[model samples]
Target: MTAIPPLDPPARLLMGPGPISAYPSVLRAMSAPLVGQYDPFMTGAMSDTQELYRQVWATENDATLLVDGTSRAGIEAALVSLVRPGDRVLVPVFGRFGHLLAEIAERALAEVHRIEVEWGQVVPVSLIEEAILRVKPHVLALVQGDTSTTMNQPLDEVGAICERHGVLFYTDATASLGGNPFEADAWGVDAATAGLQKCLGGPSGSAPITLSDRAVEAIRSRKRIEAGIREEGDESASDFVRSNYFDLGMILDYWGPRRLNHHTEATSMLYAARECARVLLAEGRDAVIERHRLSGAAMLAGVEGLGLTVFGDVAHKMHNVVAVEIPDGVPGDAARGALLDDFGIEIGTSFGPLHGRVWRIGTMGYNARKDTVLTTLAALEAVLRRFGASVPAGGGVEAASEVYSGAAG
Candidate 1:
């Protein structure tokens, strides 16, 4: 037998820009004893999870449930199930994630129409509305927050525009779910998907998805199952839907009363997701958003006080993450490595044209606390000073402390 290596306990710190440290309670929930997939208690837990996600997504849709994968899986499941061959789909490309939506639409064999803008800027609702009018697509796909650019797309007016054009609005809220204000039903989001890794304070495995009646109808029309496998007089289903594993029609049945077999449920991930939702709900959705808002603002002020420029317009930035332009003559990788190795802090770098150009600092989930924010700022100032930058000593820490003090008062 091969020898198994003993695992070392993980070092704890606030995680920024993703997989933000999972809550201790959520980790404990995942440690619960495993139960049979069809056990009564397990089924009840499943139902409860769906209920929790409905509250988290702020939706009344009956089809709301957890997809057994990461946030991208939820996006794929929604896109693959909704768009048929040659269907028209409109995507407003603002960042890397916008390209993701376009890619998913292409995989669904949809004729994609894209309206793109500069990376740091968000797509105006009018631009998206104009694209909808021009393409007249059956589905309109967008991302609620693209962490790549640290921008949150304005969603308040998007649903109304889609409604006027008879287009179903779909959004990937993976980076914005717990930290930002989102209302699936109120925003007219026909289908929305998110992950637990960002601001949800849980491990990244399960993907929560909510579907409006309109989205469900579109999926239901294409429902199918394998043929030639039913007993005599069995009302076997059609084979209309493309992929079995990602088919939302079958997934809904499996999650619903039918209890049909799809993929085996990712039990631990479900538990983690449930606890994550429990944490958010217990905090009150608005309060959770407020916490993120304050944390992000503090981080922004601290970075600026250190003689750094924030990349995006402050008026439009997401409340959980911020992008800052790297200082000239400073090697971005070396600076990031110093923070991680020496200070045990990790922030992110960007993609595409932004590679090595900006530092994506995040104040999200478990990392949004005052101490974490202050500590990150302090360490960042130290690192910048080492790189010959003219940052005033203690400037970042002092600026962040003021934000915390003001908020508490």
Candidate 2:
């Protein structure tokens, strides 16, 4: 057998769009001893996690629970559970992830309709209202933030628009939930989903989701009995949720008081998820958001101080990530490599429409700190200078430090 060495990974400072460095407390939580899926302690942990996520999601959803997979898993569970076949789903496409929602809805056999804006700009709430008036979709699915183009779409008004038209509002908050202001109840979102990897300060694997009473009823109407739990005269829906693993109805049954069997729960990931929320809530969601705001502004100033142009509409950009244009004569990926190899700092290269045009720098999760922000800006200046692009000496870090000086909130 071929032998592999002990796990000694490079000491990297993750400064990219997602899967950023996790919180130390969250890591420690994941290392605690495991318990049986249905153990009393395990169930208690599950219930605690549900309540914590209710606070995290800013909702009073009784169906708040964790989907034991990545952010995409939570999204699918919500979409498939709430949308029956032939349901019309409207998605406002501002960036790549919006396209992802439309694709998932299409695969769910829903009649998908999309309203698109330019890649770096947000889709206005008025436009979404106009689309709803025109198409009358059953469910309005939107992305709170799309990291690919660094845009955070405004959902404040869209929710009321959906309510007026009797449409269910579901948003994928994977990239924006912990770092930005997301009021699920105030925004009138019927369903919402997010992951730990981005601003939640934890690793990817578990997806936190919440469903309003209205959204829960949508799933219950189409539930089919589990084979083992079925009685002799039990009736079944003619149509079942297409994917067993991604069905929110059965998942809810597992998470609910019935404690019915589904897949064995991911115990460690559950612990990590719980810890992430506990820390965030203890820190105060508003304060955490303000921290991200300050750090993001500092990063933006630092990048601009280095003579880099910011991409997208800054007025509506997500607070956790920023897109800076690659200068002429610099190879985008090569610069990223230099940052990683030389300075042990990692930033993201763009995808799709923004590919090779811009670099995505993140200030989020555990890495959203004064030191981490300054380090990234400093290292980026070095890399730019190494690539023969002229940059002012000490300007990047200086600008960032200036912002940090007043960032006590």
Candidate 3:
């Protein structure tokens, strides 16, 4: 047998769209000793986490909880648990994640309907209302932020439209939740799912989710007691949720006072999720959002100062990520590699229609700091020059500093 080295990873400053640096406190929380799943402390921690996420989502829903997988898992759970076979689901596809919602709905056996705009733009509320009226869907699935095009779809009016049409409204907030303004209750959202890696400053294993009472009712209607756990008088629905592991009804029982056994909880991920919420709340949710806003502004100014043209409608761009057009004659991937290899910093590449045409730079989560933004811009300026692109000396950092200076004033 050959000897292998112990795990050691390079220290890279992540300035990409997601999976950015986790908060130091969250990392420490994950290292804490574990307790049995049913132990009082474990349950107490779970309850505390639920309360924290309620504040994070700005909702008073009692059904707020964590899903044991990534953000997509949360999305799938919401779709599969609520949409029965042959139910109509209307997804307004502005970018990639919206298509993801529609695809997940399709896999859940939904009769999916989609209305799409150009990739960089958002679907207008009027168009969405028209679609809702035309399709009369049972559920309206949308993405609050789609990183592929760096667009943040306006969701405030869509929820009201869904309500008027009696459609359940759900949004995947994976890339936007903590970094952007979201009001689950005020927006009339039926369900919202998010991950910690984007703006909550944690590793990407657990998903925090909240459900309106109406969404819960829809899920409960499809509840099924698993075979081994079936007791006398336990009724199972004919259209029960297909996946046992992703069953929100059973998961809710496990999280709620019922204390039913589902899967053995991911204790470390639970801790990380808890700590992520705690740190956000301690910093004050609005204040943390403001941090992301300021950081994003600085990065934008820096990129524009470097003579890079930004993609999409700047007015509707998300506060946490931006897409910059790859300068002509610059090998996009090669430049990104040099930035990583020489500066130990990592920015993102685009996806879908944007692939190889633009670079996606993120100021999100723990990496959404003035220092990180300035550092990334400085290194990028050097890389651009090395790649035979024309960039002014210190233009990027100087422009970024001006933003910070104005904010300080």
Residue 321, model 1, lDDT: 95
Stretches of candidate 1 exceeding 4 Å from the true structure: 1-4, 9-14, 227-239
lDDT of 3: 0.94
lDDT of 3 by residue, 250-369 (tens): 999999998899999999999999999999999999999999999999999999999999999999999999999999999999999999999999999977889999999999988889
lDDT for model 1 comes to: 0.89
The predicted structure with the larger lDDT, 1 or 2, is 2
Candidate 2 per-residue C-alpha lDDT over 1-409 given as tens digits, one digit per residue, 9 for 90 to 100: 9999999989989999998999999999999999999899999999999999999989888999999999999999999888888899999998889999999999989999999989999998888988999999999999999999989998888888888999999999999999999999999999999999999999999999999988888888874757746445557543568888988888999999989998999999999999999999999999899989999999999999898999999999999999999999999999999999999999998888899999999999899899999989889999999999999998999988888886654
Identify the candidate with maximal TM-score: 3
Candidate with best lDDT: 3
Per-residue lDDT of 258 in model 3: 81
TM-score of each: 0.96, 0.97, 0.98
- Candidate 2 pairs with clashing backbones: none
In terms of lDDT, the poorest run of 10 residues in model 3 is 229-238
User: What is the Å distance of residue 266 in model 3 from its true position?
Assistant: 0.3
Please list the C-alpha lDDT of all candidates, in the order they appear: 0.89, 0.92, 0.94
